[model samples]
Target chain A: MNRFKSFVIKEFYHIFRDRRSLIVLFGIPIAQVLLFGFVITNDIRNAKIAVLDYSKDDISREITNKIVSSQYFSLAETLNNDKDIEGIFKKGRVKMVLVFENNFAHDLENTGKANIQIIADATDPNLANLLVSYLSAIIMNYTLDMNRLAVVPMQINMESRMFYNPELKSVYMFVPGVMAMILMLISAFMTSITITREKESGTMEILLVSPLRPSQIIIGKVVPYVLLSFSSAVMIILLGIFVFGMPVEGNFILLLAESLLFIILALSLGILISTIANSQQTAMLMSMVALMLPTILLSGFVFPIENMPFILQLLAHIMPPKYFIIIVKNIMLKGTGFSYVWKETLVLIFMTFFFIMLSIKKFKVRLE
Target chain B: MENQVVITSKNMIKKFGDFVANDHLNFEVYKGEIFGFLGANGAGKTTAMKILCGLLTPTSGEIFVGGFNVYTETEKIKRSIGYMSQKFSLYEDLTVFENIRFYSGIYGLSDADIKMKSNNLMDKLGLSAQRNSLISSLPLGWKQKLAFSIAIIHDPQIVFLDEPTGGVDPITRRQFWDLIYDAAHNGITVFVTTHYMDEAEYCDRISIMVDGRIEALDTPFNLMKTYNSENMDGVFLKLARA
Candidate 1:
């Protein structure tokens, strides 16, 4: 134990002595959380749109008023003719245009049907789709209100409720993902680089020949990183709660415990990487290519895994962070218990065991 | 000295697949003597040293280090020996005082012992003024000397130096040999490997390895007479040419 203590202190000295790495360690978590929370969001607020009202009627005017009154959109320009629709979108001032056909109210009154054309600039298809949906929702609500007063016999009323995230806040989605990515980056990438650094400097040989066991050496090297990654995880959670109003709906202790499990998993992966790489540069490259890219792209951090190709969906299932993100989201957003997340937690545990075993095998081979 | 064999190996062989790294090696190192193992690049000097240090297992041979079997008692062997590599292994980020303290602590030395011993070592090395300085700030010669001191900080029974004076100047190398003599005089066995034939002359006994085999082992004077050469380098050249 005394030897392990000294070894850990020496490892800490290496970390604290390097100022650039120190900055990157603490800076990345905060920056990622804040950037993902405030800047990159899917929630549309005050989206710019145009209205082309050919029907000079009270109903058309009321519908236009309703669309702009909601926080989802703001009227940017009024198009006088059909020719102005393309011009407004070409200027990039508006993402969508709502054109009501002439005699719209007359058609609704007599034939009970009216045509409203939604012309959207599909340059950014996601934003255009969202704007059209918001407009449709408002129009649907207006028609339902009209039907309620008119005593319509046949009406289909659809009620929807979004369970976990009621307001559809993007921060609720990004906070857990950012936590997974930051923890993986710090634990796997940093630890692999540190271990490979010792190998490069020839210190690892000295340590290996020392009285300390191989397990002790590995544990001592990674304990400091475990503490650091855990602290970063807590900081991200606190930022989500205070800044973005995201709730930790489940047991806080369970969430932290699961974060620790994932951190250990990532550290074991780092050990495996270090065993394969002979230099710090190789370890760094391997970690970025194998761990970071997969965590960012295939783990559903930015894009939905279900929307990927069939082969990519199969590939995503093998990523450890995919399960970790799900576990975190379940605990933080849905307030789910261990029962709800047992499979994901089990997968993480199995992966940790597998990586540790592989690392030990490779380390022994290296010694030989 | 007495016939106290500190290291004994009989027909020790280490093979990487079909290539024999240390083929049929046989030697015995007595206690309190400076024994040198000399070889050219890829002559299997490092492979033999690693086996002696308990870092690798011999393919099929009997080897003992510090009275512990190299195959079954590797952990015990590790605790009883000190090893320094050719690459000057020391934590450059750590201060001179901290490096000593760290190595001593891992060797199971107490805090009080480490404090006193480190002070004594720094004072002896004339590094007391730079005790707080990082190892990287010191000159190459000073760093090599400090690394040697730290390797033996535990007072192990045997110290293995694998080209400990590789990159330093001749003056520092001479001074390093002086340090080696001092340690040997204190009754610690020194096992060193080097390619510098001149340095081999300073050893009590030298073994020259060629093609994964020890071609010659004798005192410098005996080797000179047998090879009909004036110096250790000339003897090495003749053996390598043969």
Candidate 2:
């Protein structure tokens, strides 16, 4: 027990003594969270828009004020003629434009129908899609509010509704993905590098020749990484909850327990990688190419797996992050319990056990 | 030297496929003597040492280290022997005291024993002022000597040195031998491998390996006379060329 404790202390000294590793271990998580929250977001505020009211009447003007006052859209220019609609779009000043058709109040009152035109710049397709839908939702809300006061309601079958997240904030999607990514990269990177460093520097020879068993050396090296990655995982969760207003609707303890399972999964993968790699550079390269890229691209973190090609979708199914993201999203957003996440938990547990077994086998092969 | 065997091997054959690394080798090392193991590169020196250290399993052999069988009692053998490889084994990022304390602790030394031994070691090496300095900051010779000290920190019965003085001045190498002599004087067996033929003369007995076999083994003076050579280097050349 004292030998194990001494080994662990030695590992901590290696971790805290290096400035580059300290920065990577603690600094990257918070920076990634804040960057995803504020910079690369889908939520828009005060987007510039142009208006053209051919009707020039009270009802059209009232609807225009409602759109601008919602804070999601701001009026850039009010054109007199339709000629400037295409001209303003070419100038790239506004993301969207709204056109109210002629005799809007007369048509709505008599026939309960009125036409409105929405033009958007689709040069950047995702942003354009978001802009047009946000404008349509604002107009629909105004019409619904107007219907409550009037005796008649408009016959509109198509309605817009977003559940679990009414505002459809992009931060909610990124938080879970970021947690999986940060935990996987940090835990795996730390373990793989630490183990391979001994081999690279010739320390493994001395360690192997000592009375300490190989299992004791491995477990002692890994215990410190577990604590480091878990604390950083906690830091990310707290940042998501308090800073970005993310929801933790599920049982908090279950959420943490699930996170622990994922961390152990990553740690075991690192050990397996170290067993295969002979140098620290090889270990780091393998972790980046094998773990990081898949976590970011194929795991549905930044890209939706459903929209991917058939082959890539099949590839994404093998990635651990895909299931971890699902587990996190279900618990945090859907307010689910163990019954909903048991399958994912089992998958993570199985992967951890599989990697650990492979590592032991590889280590034994080295002895021969 | 006492006529007590600390290490012995009988018909040790370690083969890697068609190539043989240690072929039918046999030798014995007695207690309280500096025994030298010499060979050219790839002459099977490292392979034999690893098998004796209980790190590598032999293909077929009867080997005993500190009276423990290499196959059935590897753990006991590990506890009774210490090793220093050619490459620097101490953690460069750690301090001198920290490295010593860590190695001693892992060998199951008590805290009080570690404390006293570490201080005495630093004082004897005249490095007491640099006790807390990182190994990376120390000179290469100091690091090499420190590595040798930590290898036998637990006062094991036998200490193995695999070319422990590779890249250092001759004066420092001589000082390293002084330390080895001190250990042997304190009744510890020293099993050392080196390519420096001049250093081989200091050993009480030395073995020369060519290919995968021990071509010659004797006292340095006897081997010099048998080969009709003036020095240990000439004796090595005569056997290697044959």
Instruction: Pick the lDDT winner.
Output: 1
- Candidate 2 per-residue lDDT, tens place, A186-225, comes to 8898899999999999999999999999999999989998
Clash number for each model: 0, 0
Q: Give the alpha carbon lDDT tens digit for every residue of A58-157 in model 1.
A: 8999999998989898999888899988788788998989999999999998888998999999999888888788789889999998888887787789
Model 1 CAPRI rating:
high
lDDT of 1 at A201: 94
In candidate 1, list every pair of residues with a backbone clash.
none
Write down the DockQ of candidate 2: 0.84
lDDT of 2 by residue, B78-124 (tens): 99998998786999999999999999989999899999999999998
Per-residue CA lDDT of model 1 for B1-242, tens digit only, reads 65899999999999999999999999999999999999899999999999998889999899999999999999999999998988889899999999998999899999999999999999999999999999989999999999999988899899999999988899999999999999988888999998787899999999999999999999999999999999999999998889
What are the per-model DockQ values?
Answer: 0.87, 0.84
